[model samples]
Target chain A: MLTKRIIPCLDIKNGRTVKGVNFVDLRDAGDPVELAAIYAAEGADELVFLDITATVEKRKTLIELVKRVAAEINIPFTVGGGISSIADVSALLNAGADKISINSSAVMRPELVSELAGEFGSQCVVVAIDSRFVEGEHIVHVSGGRIATERRTLLWAKEVEERGAGEILLTSMDHDGTKAGFANELTAKVSGSVSIPVIASGGAGNQEHFLDSFTIGLADAALAASIFHFKEVSIPDLKNYLKGYNIPVRIEK
Target chain B: MSVVIVDYNAGNVQSVTYALERLGVSPVLSADPEVIRSADRVIFPGVGEASTAMRFLKERKLDEVIKDLKQPVFGVCLGLQLMCAHSEENNTDCLGIFDVQVKKFEPTLKVPQMGWNNLEHTTGPLFKGIEADSYVYYVHSYYAETSEYTIATTDYVNTFSAALNKDNFYALQAHPEKSGKVGERILQNFLDIK
Candidate 1:
């Protein structure tokens, strides 16, 4: 009875959790370490810190931030963005991050997945696939959705799994920022196709969206950034709603 | 009392070190047999392939070191899996501390039982403060079936050993480092163990 996971993805830019911090109560909540503690205390199943930059120096800041955030929270923490090599992944893991997510780097070098999973474990490697609907086909997009590849979303999902990725963080570019809902059609297709766990990311406007991700999308986990940062949907409140719906979720008391 | 985290190049050692540090315990990460033998407590935390990791342990003779250590040792995730008799993972032979077999979870639901699950039928000092149905995080495909060493049980496609205890060795199938407050309480319990 492994419960479905609810993850709050913290978009970190220049070491701060960027975007949608308008909650009056957390007016001074720019620090990721502070935000992570609050989310972990409020019953977040896991936390993901995505360093939204490609700068080499920003990678250092991201690692430092991971150390600080990890120190304050006990739940599983995932650090992603700009992770390209075994050195980068090992550094983050050494700094206390539980899992490392590789996006564009993984797409550029699919072999990196097997190499990292070889050194570390598949359980510590998360391959995040950012996909967009392109002319009736879901195309894999990389470089934070700025670069589109010819690879099909479902095909790339299978590729990463074959490369020994433990989980897939599938993000729908069209559904992102729209809050309309997650791309359940694509998510369900990928989740059904892969043997590993699938984390449905983006377009999570409400608790119902999360429910859809689980039921319709068949996702093992759901990840959202704005819904959590803006305090529109607290982790405890969301978990409570999901619990009543009979979706198995960890309720931290 | 000194604490040493047995390091065999398996991942998740740093997370466990941080968890121990939060409890005001500084641990030394070492692969030296003497260092591990002399430590007052040892936390064998790991997350990796069983055969690959056991090979590294055997390479450094840590396999024998771990088996012979008389100090209180706590194994987490892959650490627990490696303590069992043998694992279906690569047909790997393990340390045999728990005298049980680790089998791959049947893909009745999901291959990897990822995320939190409740602990039930729990006993022993490892679960002293934790209540029934209290959740802990788990992320693995292989699990040891409930056995004589099983101190805690959980259901995930089947009843499996969540925690096991044999003499001075205690192990958990879940990653307590990532299991939050209840996990910290469990780590504290291990630190307080004589």
Candidate 2:
């Protein structure tokens, strides 16, 4: 019996957790390793550390950070952002990441998905689709939503699966910072079309939002940043809440 | 007294290495037959396609080395699939350690069984203190059919062997290294095997 996954994403800039992270424990709480451990203890199903580092030298630091986090947390780990080639995937997987997420590059060269899947297996590849509703339809966005492509969201989802991607991380740009809820409407369209697991990311404000993502959106996993990062919603409390709704989740004993 | 993680072209060996290190066991990650056979326990972990990985193993004759290993051998994910008689992953024949066939999960239910899932119908020492329905993480599309080697079973579209036990060779579809406490406990139980 597979349970719904709750993934807390940590955005790393220059090898350290950026934006905001709860320092609930430890002397220096900003470290991704500390945060990963805390999240693991809090019953997070998995952890995603997005390395937002730019430049050649800084990427090396991100790799080192990945190694530290992998050693600290025993749960499934994913590293994303700025991963463009097989070499990058190899480096991260070698550093102990269980999976690697490809966003812009996946949209740029869809073949990269199969290439990574061939080299590292489909289970290790995740194609993250950043989509925004434009002109009455969902359109794929690239370069962190700066430019929109003509690619239809549902079509792209199917393409990635055929190309050998194991999972799809569907993030709604409109709902991302708003926190109103997940794009259940768009998510259902994509999730229904694909056979692989779909992770509903962005716009996770409350427990009900997560419930909707799982039930209405039909997503295998739900991911959020601020909600989990700021301690506004603790994972244990949220999992208990979801369990009350009959959502199958792994609760701490 | 030694534990060695058999390394081929598998992807997620580092996590397995990290998991062992946390248990205070410094495991040697190796593809060499000598290092693998010499160890008290050998963990054959993998996260790749069946045919390609088999080619890598066969190229170096690691396949024979793995099959000849008399020590307690544990296979994970692709390793489990490859240890079976054949796999639908690439219509490739496998090492035949488990005497079962690996089939692709029907797309009607979902391809890869991602996230944390529980193991049921549990038995054997690998499960030990781990209760039935104890949640562990899994990420795989191909699964081994339930057989005499099966120690535990789980269902998605259909019930499959979540964990298998045959003599000294043990294999599970789940990634115990990344499965949190229950996972750690399973690994610890494997380590405690003497």
Candidate 3:
């Protein structure tokens, strides 16, 4: 049976894990390698490390941080943010990262997704889409959910899938940081539209919210930040809650 | 000593490298004939269109080098397809190491067969201790038609060769690296085979 994944996303900046509200106003979380090991031990199926800084100085540091984390952690990790070319994807994958997530760069050059998928296997490629509800329509946003694209979320998701994205990480900008719950409706819509696995991101405050994302949204995985980072909800506790709810999860020995 | 993973422009080499590392072996990714011949073992993993992959191998003259390798060799997914005499995918010619042809699975059974499927009829050192009917990960539309080379079989819509073995040459239609513990065990078994 396929296990539903529980992932804790960490934003790395200046070689440290940081968290922010709405992708701004960052505060220190912890060392990425330490946080990653904690999550893996707690039964997280995987981890995603996004380099939040856009400047050149921090980019080099972030790549080095990715190398360190990849070296230490045994579980699958995905590195994203500012990934522009096949070389970037290769660098992360070579560093022991299991997958690479592309956002702004992917939207700008959709062909890169296909090219990377061709070179590496599709399972190594993940496309992260930041979407916000604009006038009752889900519009795609890039550059950390700041710039809105003309493309609709669902349409772009279909395009990415056809381009050979192994999985879709759909983050609802509208619900991000709200802690109200996941955008179940949007996740369900995208999951239904794409043949590949869809991972629901944003708006998780509690264990029940995770369940809602799995049951209502039909998401294959649920990713969150502060809730897991702040220890407001431990991954084992959350998995226990989900197991009580009968959601399939891999229990660690 | 580093294991050599042939880079013939096929996919899944990264996963194989990671899997080997998990089993405490570091592999060197290479396409050069000398590098491959000098390594402890050679892994020929593949993904993507069979015809295009074969063309890449032929262009690099890796086709002949791979056929003459004296060390143990392993193939996965499209790698298995290419080892066969022919493939239904793009009607391409292959290495013909094993007298078998890769055929496309029935369209009605979901073209890709993308998920966990059970392995049956297991018989090989590669599957040594792996329980029968254990699920291994798979993703592809074409499969190797049953032949004397086949050592294991699986069923999606119908039974087909899940694994093939002939002397030092071994190929798996499913990805053992991505298949979790069962996959890791299979890989360990492959490494243990002397």
Candidate 4:
């Protein structure tokens, strides 16, 4: 009977919140701390802060930002991007993040997922997969969707779950920034294949898309950026809409 | 006054500290018996294998110290599991504060019942203004069956105790620290209790 979560992902660059189209043309959303507090108050089930510049900068702003956001909001927040080592995961957790998300690093070194999960528990480690449709198959994308690996989405997700990843954040690069709807087919494939919680991301335009992602995608949570950042769809409005559709949601007091 | 959180290789201590700080309560992380006993309240949070964690606790004599504490104590996730008489996890004996055994979830349902779950049957001051059937986040495979100490119940594949209370000892299977406002309100209720 766990409530279906409504999450808003904030892509951070240079300590500022930014959202872009297809991971480019970045625009300033606002201060991460401010935006995180707003989302928490507005009934967001959780928050995801991805330091988009972590690899290029060779440093992570997520830990400090997580510390600041954790000081303000009383909800679960996940920090991801440029998490390459156990030290990085430890730092983010110490900074107050409830979960640490790893993308390219985890893909490159699959053992890192199990190692961290073994040390910190699987519940704290989230394996984020950026997948793109290629030649009629979902191929795993790395380096922030710049490079496509030979592995298929379902194959890698299964491996990560076997290696002890507690949750999977599946974002479809083709659907990202499209504002159409989630990759329901791909999500359902992964959700049906893995027992871990699957958070569906990318291509969420309206409330119907959210509903589709849950009912059809079979996702435990639906995560979006543009719709939430631009105020095209508020968390409460979305939650009310989902409730009307028989999806269990936690209404704000 | 700062609450002391015992860090004996358990999980979620940092999140608990973070949640307390967000509530305007500063909490200090410590494993020293003196620090824990001196604090206004003590929080015991854990994750990972129960037997291994119990080994860490027993080695530090924390098991004895934690049992002898007079201040209010709160256990989260595996911390709650370890406070029981025994756990199916690694077949380890626990602190016996709750006199119950923690059993693994039925294999029929998915292992590690992750994500947000609703607390259906609830009571005690910890629930306070929180409505029955409120949702809280959970991630675990083992669960404590209903017992005399159970204060809240949640349903997944089946109904199980989500929260337990006995005297000054309180434990929650779900991560209240990560459960958002309902969780924050529960934390505030615990802080307000005499």
In terms of DockQ, the best-performing candidate is 2
lDDT of 1 by residue, A1-253 (tens): 6899999888889898787765565646788888788888889889898888657876678878888877778999899988889999988988888899999998888999999988888888999999999899999999889899989999999999988898999999999999999999999999999999999998999999999999999999999988888878888889899989999998866
lDDT per residue for candidate 2 within A1-253, as digits (tens), equals 6899999999989888896776666567667888888889999999898888878887999889988888879898889999999999999988988899999998889889999987887888999999999999899999888899989999999999999999999999999989899999999989999889999998998999999999999999999998888888899999999999999999857
Q: lDDT tens digits, residues B3-73, model 3?
A: 88899766536667777887899889998989998887888998678889999999999999988887788
Residue lDDT tens for model 4, A1-253? 7778999998888777774423222243467787777788788888998887745454555566777887778788898888889988888887888898999998899999999988888888999999999999999999989999999999999999999999999999999989899999999999999888899999999999999999999998999987887788989999999999999888855
Highest lDDT model number: 1
C-alpha lDDT of residue A137 in model 4: 90
Off by over 4 Å in 1: A25-27
Model 4 misplaced regions, further than 4 Å: A19-29, A54-60, B107-109
Off by over 4 Å in 3: A19-29, A41-43, A69-75, A94-96, A109-123, A231-253, B11-15, B18-22, B34-39, B68-70, B98-123, B128-162, B173-183
Residue A62 alpha-carbon offset, candidate 2, angstroms: 0.5
Cα deviation of B99, candidate 2, in Å? 1.9
lDDT of 2 by residue, B1-194 (tens): 69999888667788898899998999998888888889999999988778889999999899999998887888887888888999987799899988899998887778788888889998988989987688988888878999998999888778999988888888889998988988888888888776
Clashing pairs in 1: A1-B155, A1-B156
Q: How are the candidates ranked when ordered by DockQ, highest leading?
A: 2, 1, 4, 3
Query: Which docking category, incorrect, acceptable, medium or high, applies to candidate 3?
Result: incorrect
The per-model lDDT (C-alpha) reads 0.90, 0.88, 0.82, 0.86
Chain A TM-score, structure 2: 0.98
